[model samples]
Target chain A: MTMRSNRIGLLTALLLASTGMPAYAGEQAVIIDNFAFQPAQLTVDAGTTVVWTNRDDIPHTVASGDSTLRSPPLDTGDVFRFAFTQKGTYRYFCTLHPHMQGTVIVR
Target chain B: MLDVSEGRRDALKCMLWGGAGVLWTVAGGVPKSRVLAPAMADETGDGNFSFVQISDSHIGFAKSPNMDTPGTLRAAMDQVRRVRDSARLLIHTGDVSHLSHDAQFDTAAQIIGEAGLETHYVPGEHDVLVDDGKNFFARFASGAPHGGWYSFDHRGVHFIALNNVQNLKAGGLGNLGAEQLEWLERDLRGRSASTPIVVLAHVPLWTVSQEWGWGTADASLALTYLRRFGSVTVLNGHIHQVMQKVEGSVAFHTARSTAFPQPAPGAAASPGPIKDVPAGKLRSLLGVTAVRRVQASTRLAIIDTPLGG
Candidate 1:
């Protein structure tokens, strides 16, 4: 099953690349470390699911502006996944520490 | 570093943090600090009334430096019980639960309720996250003015409970939303400037560290209203450490956590718990702050008492 999914993800990436779109894997991971989002800014293709894994000792959340995403309190080692099916820019922040923010440009 | 008595060790630890044994007194709009031992400091001061401030219990947290959060809170409660005869009431600054879980709130209520004293609470960002404070307000705050913010009078002192954690804006610090600010303006209206005002919230009203998100965003306007008071004591938590600031007659203080200790401002990369606390040294890092004022005393003394020493 893993091999099958990998092939399908690669095929989808190829199709998006042929259309002159940002080629991104179907799944992307963002690390929450040091009370900040590692990338802080990300560019992902449509239909890509973004996963945020909390690596810091404290808890955080990935909450979006237009309600595109909302994660429960994520403790250390916990993960919150959201699929960005629409093509738009998404802004999110950790409600617990709102100073920590990020932007996702979905193409 | 060497074999020393627990009391002396605590004194050393307190010296490093600049917290314990320092009695704060505000006279004629000027603040003064004098060192005193915690044991001697607890004596029924010449003040007419005294209350307790407990904060950042962070129940349901099981991690380094402190494995059992509830256990530390219980121990801290024991210290409070010891002074039940002298301490008139209890004020918890916030963070009653780590994840705002139902069982976590239940455990906190069960333990704090044992004090058998009326406890007033404000919502921490953590407590309001799970259900927008549905669980927190239901259990700890009912009929609270302006949604988990209210004001009460005790011993001729006016206590204002402000909730700066709710509706926090993105890329901003803790916020007392616009509606709540409007309510606060109305609440303070008609009160004389001589009223001793005590403001309680989870986040420090003063900017302790902007990078760490340890302050409230709209606190400047709130302070504008409070600065006129003769004696204004602003007690806050969520930093998990003791910090103080005095501007004129208004004194701002942040209490230590009962669960675990976080690094001082800018001391660590993040404001997370200090995991490497030396073995047998955790209790000294955790403490409860007492707010007391003697008869005819013009200042409110906030003393931090460690659970162990």
Candidate 2:
């Protein structure tokens, strides 16, 4: 019975590892549209991955406030993902169009 | 028509005569010889290689600061001609019109042409409003493939006109785009690094302020190409203010507007007309810069003189 239980535990661990699941399964998404960012502000836990999808026809990008973090320009159907490792309110915007703005709050 | 008394008529005539005499005195009397002599001296000094920088003309504007839009533009043109020296070039830095209207462009062209000099232009955000810069490209795309960015050699100095307002960002630095970046890289490939490069564009390459719409999108990429050149002078005109920055081998300068002046960054509620000044002081608020490359070194001395100075 102990041998059978150990096999079952190993199988469960392997399954979890293969799935690539985060510890808390925390992730978020934001959309860019019509010269503006939908849900312009978001709050997520530390280590959460935030994905920005460009729904507008034109190109856009997410650049950090101090201009440190920059995503490649995203056309329609393009997406950019950034993992929030630090805890702070980070404001970003489309470098191609300055009026479009969004914020990612990691805590 | 004869409602007034003879005495009142006589007084009015006397007043008119007195006013005409004062006007004559102001125009043609006294030591007016001194003013004319100095003007002649200025003309002599201006005979050298000089150019006029008219930035952010913003024609077709219907604001209170200048309701008669064309009139104010004509006033600016008068100022241009008053100080314009023979054999000078006219460099317009962008925003020649407000809405990219054909009529506005025509008017601007007429007024600028009246200065009677070779005019070079770069498009502004207002100029690229229609057809993905079709109008602006059609009008000012000399030797440039894309939205009117090109380089030319003139009088031992290199002049590069770049377009940055087409694909712009809100509060971000201007961009030269990838294609233009590639072209710029290739264009500068054969040129010597010691060439004095004067880069003119619509938006400032340097970061003026991120909160307000005073910066460009991807200016760093273009700057990377420019870093190889010695004495790189980057001139832009979006902010409509006189701001200068010098960063190790590059000097960035922005000229004042030929139209109305916007408020200083972070000073007003938003970027618009800054009121509360006396009426006669309006012209002093706006002006241009005269840049001259001194001999021997790659250094340029710029004089920012206010309008009617």
Alpha-carbon local distance difference test for all models? 0.75, 0.63
* C-alpha lDDT (0 to 100) for residue B107 of candidate 2: 86
Model 2 residue B265 CA deviation (Å) reads: 1.1
lDDT of 1 by residue, B1-309 (tens): 754575455434433322222233433433233322234335545454656778888888876655567666776666666556656778889999998999999999999899887888988888987878888998888868437888999877788999999777788898998788888899998999888788899999988889988889999999888877777888888887766666667777777777777777767887877766663564444333344332223353434333221
| Candidate 1 ranges with C-alpha deviation above 4 Å | A1-16, A19-25, B1-42, B45-47, B279-309
Predictions' DockQ, in order: 0.70, 0.12
C-alpha RMSD of each candidate structure in angstroms: 6.4, 14.6
| Docking class for candidate 2 | incorrect
Model 1 lDDT, full chain set: 0.75
Worst 10 residues of 1 chain B by lDDT: B14-23
TM-score of each: 0.82, 0.60
Best by DockQ: 1
